[model samples]
Target: MIVPICSCYGQTEDGILSKHEKWEFVLEDTGDVLQIAIPLAAGLTTLFKKDYKGSKQFALSYATSLVVTHSLKRIIRKERPEDRNLFDAFPSGHTTSAFSGASFIQRRYGWKYGKWAYLGAAIVGVSRMEGPDGWHDIWDVLAGAAVGIGSTYLFTTPYEKQPVQVGFYSNGNDTYILSLKYEF
Candidate 1:
């Protein structure tokens, strides 16, 4: 997917900072789309499963992340890495959105499914620090991720409920029926 975008910008060394300008551009655009897509996708998944509770949980987490991220950005008034004149750069909003969705997926579904979302979220973080035109520093990205994950942790729970399982266990000549329920 990235190969075509990289080739379009000609050579990477031609960039102002000798960084892959094409990669930076592609990453920035991709990250922008992903920030929205991830949350939408999570929402769709919940709808497909008919899990309204999970949907509400994810929405709350996402909303909390947005509020917290924007509040911090406004309060800190930190300058962007690329331009000191711009102030709302203390927390990368793109990273916050991406991580919020990713963490919600992990919290609701499970790691087996959420790992891919996390990988995409990590890419969004990288995009924020990719090139001369990068918008944020590591601190901003880290804080955004922390806020996202923290918010989700406060609201989300697993989609699958562990029900009591009644089964028979046999060892040698002994047989027993047991009921089990696993707790988080």
Candidate 2:
């Protein structure tokens, strides 16, 4: 239902492909490689910080979500708008992967990094729209976000203690600092 509506409303082939060509400069295979690698690194960092279970949970969730989405896409085999390929576009896999990473970061670091994390996810959504092999509408991106965030939160262990006082401060010398005081 949602997929069909999105597909109907999305930009035509020329519009979408034009954007794709522009984004190709920055969002090519190398970019995807970085996207995949960075999140795994962040998850490992969480593990080293003694959140071993949480890290493992995030890693597994991310991987599982990607696999499931990709498999479903393969089975559906919906054709891309440009006819460049045949894979389901009901949900954007790259967007899902981006959201999964962002969710992991938010869970491990709290809301301090939330803005940037979500910004990255948004970029992925846009990239998906721009790419030849991409999703057509907001629904697809939303669906991907749901799967990514849901999997991460459901699989991770709850924080032992929430941060009591989390805030930021700026000095007169144009310097800023963030402080987190936790109570366990």
Candidate 3:
């Protein structure tokens, strides 16, 4: 299965290179997407109420995945399809990083946000294939994604805290008091 997928991606890479030079810009800009996803994922961590540990877990998982993927790239040192570059392309570093950040966002938020993050990750993966280097096969992207998602789940503690609600009420005299309650 992996071999066939890699072959298909190689074929697709040819078509992308032949058809679209403009895609190079898109490929380059995917770095900015990763920049944004990381911070946004961190911000979403606060929404889990008392799950500070979970927040740390999410952040750490993302960082660890990035390091692991990049290190593996150096070790494998597979040549890019274009041969213009000699850098390893066996498991896409860009795709791994993007998915790591995206998975962090998705785990902290809900599917609505997860869907958008995943879509952005897809774009990054496609951009890698479209780049001038023409590195990475479909299996590479898939493996990178699995590594990212798996690490995120493995590191993050499950959300087990009960929800707490805080409300503000104002009296006629313009005085306000906040009331707090725990649910479940």
Best candidate according to TM-score? 1
**Each candidate: RMSD:** 9.2, 12.0, 8.0
Instruction: List the candidates ranked by lDDT, beginning with the highest.
Output: 1, 3, 2
Instruction: List lDDT for all candidates, in order.
Output: 0.84, 0.67, 0.67
State candidate 3's TM-score.
0.66
Clashing pairs in model 1, backbone N/Cα/C closer than 3 A: none
How many angstroms is residue 154 displaced in model 3 relative to the true structure, after the best TM-score fit? 0.8
Against the true structure, candidate 1 reaches a TM-score of: 0.77
Model 3 agreement with the true structure over 18-110: per-residue lDDT tens digits: 333444645646744664564465547555465677667867887788778888789887776755456667677777777776776677556
Point out the worst 10-residue segment of candidate 2 by lDDT.
1-10
Q: By the TM-score metric, which is better: model 1 or model 3?
A: 1
What would you estimate as the lDDT of candidate 3? Answer: 0.67
Residue 157 alpha-carbon offset, candidate 3, angstroms:
3.8
Better of 1 and 3 by lDDT: 1
| lDDT measured at residue 35 in model 3 versus the true structure, 0 to 100 | 41
Model 2 collision count: 0
